[model samples]
Target: MKNYILIICAVMLSQVSSAQTSQTADKKAILSVLKMQRLAWSDNNIEGFMEGYWKNDSLKFYGSNGITYGWENTLERYKQAYPTADHIGTLSFKINDITKITDDAYYVMGEYHLKRNVGNATGIFMIILKKIEGEWKIIADTSS
Candidate 1:
């Protein structure tokens, strides 16, 4: 009986380790998406940068001004704010933390900095990312 119990515990430990490994892989994939967006932003490729976001009418973005709904609307807002490479500037991200809410959801807190010939700006941002159809995408964002 003791030998059987020991075998069961070993199996349970193996399962737990497998789960942790998978979770770590998922986190790396999520971070990769953010890194891709940061590179796209620095390249002044708004469309490419938006590839990280969930392209749906239900998508939401909140900033100091107010809330904006829909992916297209958010994209338009970005165009209006930036307009040209000169305005878009060089972008960088400092991810402070990432918290997994569930297997399908995660939240990221980070700071974004923009360096432009016109001026420079920096702010903190929180984004909620969700895995949909096997792809992770940002569903909501609030930035100051």
Candidate 2:
């Protein structure tokens, strides 16, 4: 009976360790997407930055002005707001927390800063992402 209990404990421990490892890998993948976005933004490539978002009509982005729906609409809004390189600015992000909602979804909270010769602005943001087609994509974003 004691041996049976020990074996059960060992199995449970291995499962927990495997789950943790999977979560860590997911977190790293998410962080890589953010890094790609930051680099794209700093380069003033709005299209490249938008690549981080899901390319679906159901996609949503809530910004300081209001909520925008659809990937194309979000891209348009970004273009209207940052029309020139001076406006695009150099961007950076400080991720505070990342929580896995399920095997295919995650929520991320972070702070973003944009520095440009025109001015500098900083704000906090929350993004919900999902694994789609084997890649992580932001499904929704709320930025203030």
Candidate 3:
């Protein structure tokens, strides 16, 4: 009877450890995706930065201008707004939170800073990411 209790405790502990490990890995992968986005943006590579986003037409972006749906539309919007390296600027992020919505999804809240000769810009953003095809992609974004 004592051995049965011990076995149950061991199994529970193992499961908890496994969950923690998976959570940590998922968070790390999510951060990696954001890092890639920052680097690509700072390099004036909007196309590269968009690689972090879901390519599906359902991808959504809500901003001060209004909501923009679909991946291609978002890309065009970015290109139109930035237009040049000076306008694109150097991108950096101050992450406030990364909350797990499920095993395969997370929502990140952060502030973005863009330093440029034209002018500096800062804004807050919340983006939803989901693991698809073993890769994390931003499915929705809201910025102001």
* Candidate 3 residue-wise lDDT, 23-102, digit = tens: 89998999999999999999989999999999999999999999999999999999999999999999999999999999
**What is the clash count for each candidate, in the order shown?**
0, 0, 0
lDDT of 1 at 85: 92
Model 3 global lDDT (CA atoms, 0 to 1)? 0.96
**Candidates arranged by lDDT, highest first:** 2, 3, 1
After superposition, which runs of candidate 1 have C-alpha atoms over 4 Å from their true positions?
A: none
Q: Rank the candidates by TM-score, best first.
A: 2, 3, 1
Candidates' RMSD to native = 1.1, 0.6, 0.8
lDDT of 2 at 79: 99
- Tell me the tens digit of each residue's lDDT in model 2 across 26-130: 999999999999999999999999999999999999998999999999999999999999998999999999999999999999999999878998999999999
Candidate 2 wrong stretches, greater than 4 Å = none
lDDT: which is higher, 2 or 3?
2
| Candidate 2 lDDT score relative to the true structure | 0.97
**Candidate 1 local lDDT, 1-144, one digit each (tens):** 999999999999999999889788888989999999989998999999999999999999999879999999999999999999988889889999888899889999999999987799899999999999999999999999
- Give the best candidate by TM-score: 2
Q: Which pairs of residues have clashing backbones in candidate 1?
A: none
Best by lDDT: 2
TM-score of 1: 0.95
